[model samples]
Target: MVSDGANNTMAFPRETVLKVASLARLQLTPEEVDLFATQLGATLDYVARLDELDVSNVEPMVHAIELTNVLRDDVLVPSLPRHDAVANAPKTDGKYFLVPAILES
Candidate 1:
């Protein structure tokens, strides 16, 4: 939104939005950009209003499913053998199966 001159509106066209997204390495279509601009504005407005509320002692919740850790007997049971477990793994070196790195290089 930093403008090169004064008195400029931050508003942008749908095509410009698509081009900006392309520069951002995104491939959103013109229609998608229009939809996103509307949704994004609404989302930002909602978040702005959330700051007006004072939630000082509100306990953060994990899920509203109303279910806690599933209970089970504390007793342990035999599991798959170590060799059998690693039989089909693509790579196993340190007594564990190694998986591909999730992060891009």
Candidate 2:
């Protein structure tokens, strides 16, 4: 267990820490596990404290600043021909670019 500045405490068990580390594909040393257990406990405690705030009158907002769609009007534009587009390609099979196979059978 660890305490946040607001007096709230949260338990960060070793099993839970190990599970999180495994899910994230991380390799943590025993020393790192102990360090993260305390850190994650305090973080969870701080987040738990947010539940005590009054938000009944608050409106849901997607972002802190006001936002509006700023997209440009859709319009047809000139484009390079397929041959021109492939001109700079390192390897091309006339109509498409080719690359080395990336996977093993």
Candidate 3:
């Protein structure tokens, strides 16, 4: 465990940790800030350790298991009319659905 004192042993500086938290819009306590700094530093150290591995011959893959794309051929199909689609809706602006505003200036 990393100490929350001046004589701490974290890979990242306290100020850096606080800056990251601020950018993320997180409100962290002093203790939480120290803890997160220690944890994040340890994570970075682990990633650094991984950088030393020899993977030059390995092929890049998106998943650990083999996978194949399963998709249907694109085809035009009959669909519901716009009026019928919004018939049961509580609110609609004729061509589009009406939703509550989310942001305030």
Cα RMSD of all models vs. native, in order, equals 10.5, 7.5, 6.9
Task: Compose the digit string of candidate 2's lDDT tens values, residues 2-103.
Answer: 354343233676788899999999999999887777777778766787799899999889888878987887998889999999989999987999998979
Ranking under lDDT, best-scoring first?
A: 2, 3, 1
Ranking by TM-score: 2, 3, 1
lDDT of 3 by residue, 1-105 (tens): 433334344778789988888899988999998877777776766567668889999988988887798788799988999988988889997777888897885
Worst 10 residues of 2 by lDDT: 1-10
lDDT of 1 by residue, 76-97 (tens): 9999999889888889973799
lDDT of 1 at 90: 85
Off by over 4 Å in 3: 1-8, 22-25, 73-104
**Candidate 1 regions with alpha-carbon error over 4 angstroms:** 1-27, 72-105
Clash pairs, candidate 3, are none
